[model samples]
Target chain A: MTDAHEIRHEIRIATGDDIVRIRRAVRTVACAARMSLVDRTKLVTAASELARNVIGHGGGGTVRIERLISPSGVSGVRMVFEDAGPGIPDVRLALTDGWSTGQGLGLGLPGARRLVDEFDLQTVVGEGTRVTVTKWTR
Target chain B: MDRVPILKAGDVLLVSIQTDLEDRTVMALREDLAERIVRTGARGVVIDITAVEIVDSFIGQMLAGIAAMSQLLDARTVVVGMRPAVAITLVELGLSLGGVQTALDLETGLRLLGAGPLDGGPSEAQDRR
Candidate 1:
């Protein structure tokens, strides 16, 4: 049959159009990897929320996607979004629900983190913000 | 954030959501929306969320609550023009609207509520039942 290398793909895109493109790209990548429907939906949702945060709060950012091969022979996906905007002044407050600076309930980051298996975030006031999320399937 | 009045045009009520819908504002909006649903006895309610860039867990919960109240009040509640990011965030947060209807845009939202755009002053909508 065919080689396993034929199944992998990656994506990199800007956070524009309020994160719609990012979600579509995520869905395409996840589907091609043959992820479960539940996992695919969750992954897409997580990507969408994170990308939106970069656009709305961070002003703009970049999104990167990668295919991961687990040590146990499982296949999964990882996505990272980076922004060099005003950055978060208070990361802890921003992560809390009902703590939105604007009209939302502050559920974006916390919600995104919950949907994926691995989540990491790093931000600096003047530097920028980076978020990494991963989902696994054996 | 400026609080808008409940827009009544016939039996349908239009509620506008701005970019600051957190905590107390969310609670207030819920109570206000419920009151309008009861007072107008409208057949349908359309919540325009075009201006909102995010829809966090607390707001999501309140929306679901509004939908339930709408059913009990004999009115249909439809959320319209939700940004893709907001939709994703809500789903990721394990927040489901359950009985509430969603539309891609305001036009569809109003249509789902059985209301058409009126050219003149304001349109009219009344409860069928």
Candidate 2:
């Protein structure tokens, strides 16, 4: 009998050229946990978007990937994308489609949020932004 | 970023959206697709979003604009691989491109474009119009 706690793994990496590595790392973990194709796609896409945000929007940041075992006999993957970039002034407006910075398409944060089962975003005006996405498969 | 010419297959055109598909690219695609739609008289257009990580309001609006433009050319447009998170954020921010056609994958997008399927589809030469 394997302890549920023993199944968890954590990865932390810089948000530079390592963005792809972060994505691959998260994908490997999700695959090992037997996440469904659709679920896996969702997770990967979310990770890619978040990773890009840290690189493009924020100067750079840290990404943490972890596998969570819930109490309800359900398992899920949780990724936290934290950046110390100039924080979003309006979280609500930032999530709107078409409302992008004059730079890229502006779909990064909002799109990343929609790809996961549970999405949480917390940003401080002058500080930075933290986005968390979770995908669960029972 | 280097601009890649979109490919046309029979009556369908395949356009891949990567990066932050914004202004210049969106407009260029719109004009190019419109011209192709007019010249080939194709019935469908497939805009692949598999590589697109962001779809800001402008891009979303531009997508809708392109779809509208395609409609004028008598070709239907389908957007594929819209990440769920992006969809939710768009909805939350009220920047919804609700009227446009969307599919889960490229195969489905191709089907919507009137192609048989990505795999084993009839060998129809892809023409860039």
Candidate 3:
């Protein structure tokens, strides 16, 4: 298990522009890692969804991108979004498709999970929310 | 905010999404497109997204919004040239885009809207590239 990490980028999500920036940053790293085109697209889309959620739902946050070497020597990219806002009170409901408390399609959380190889979520009712997603070139 | 340009081609309004779009920009484009359709009395609208890398749920909503708005304005909306990867991602993202009509390329999209005096075919899309 190699399991090495290198921070590639740290993007602040303040406005609509930051969402675009995060998508570009993720694509850059995914391409450099020689990820396939479909994998790259899925990863980038997942990041875009999460980034928007950080602003629209989390009330604003930041995303960090990292390069990874999986256990079997596979290259991958990982991103973590962190926000200190009104955290989600219902994790299960929040991840359910077509369920939302805001003016959104209610697909952001679940959609993001479907687009990546690994997904992680942590949130506290009064604290914050943290989301981690990873996509490998395999 | 960078605005995506909307060009009037005969009775159709053509919009090519050539860059990464901010959520606000997509919203603005919706308004801009509505105004153009009404001002030009366009019978149809063509949105070319071959250059756009991804269409998240928000952008998907934007396309659906534009189509719905155009429908009420008595105009048809056709989205064209979506990348294969983007298409797969959208499906996995659970956005059926049921309300939006799509074509494989700009030429096909124009045909779907019933071309008026817009004689140019694939060249129009190629010229933009």
Maximum-lDDT candidate: 3
Task: Write down the lDDT that model 1 would get.
Answer: 0.73
Better of 1 and 2 by TM-score: 1
Better of 1 and 3 by lDDT: 3
The list of candidate 3 runs beyond 4 A from truth reads A1-3, B120-129
lDDT for model 3, please.
Answer: 0.91
- lDDT (Cα, tens digit) per residue for candidate 3, span B1-129: 789899987899999998898888899999999999889999999999999989999999989999999999999999999999999999999999999999998887988887832555455556688
Candidate 1 lDDT over B80-122, as tens digits, reads 9887666665666857666778998776687677676555334
**How many pairs collide in each candidate, listed in order?**
8, 13, 0
TM-score against native, each model: 0.57, 0.54, 0.93
The CAPRI quality class of candidate 3 comes to high
The DockQ leader among the candidates is 3
Displacement of the residue A95 alpha carbon in candidate 1, Å: 2.4
Candidate 3 chain B lowest-lDDT run of ten: B116-125
| Interface alpha-carbon RMSD, every candidate | 7.7, 6.8, 0.5
Q: DockQ: which is higher, 2 or 3?
A: 3
RMSD of 3: 3.5
Candidates' DockQ values? 0.17, 0.09, 0.85
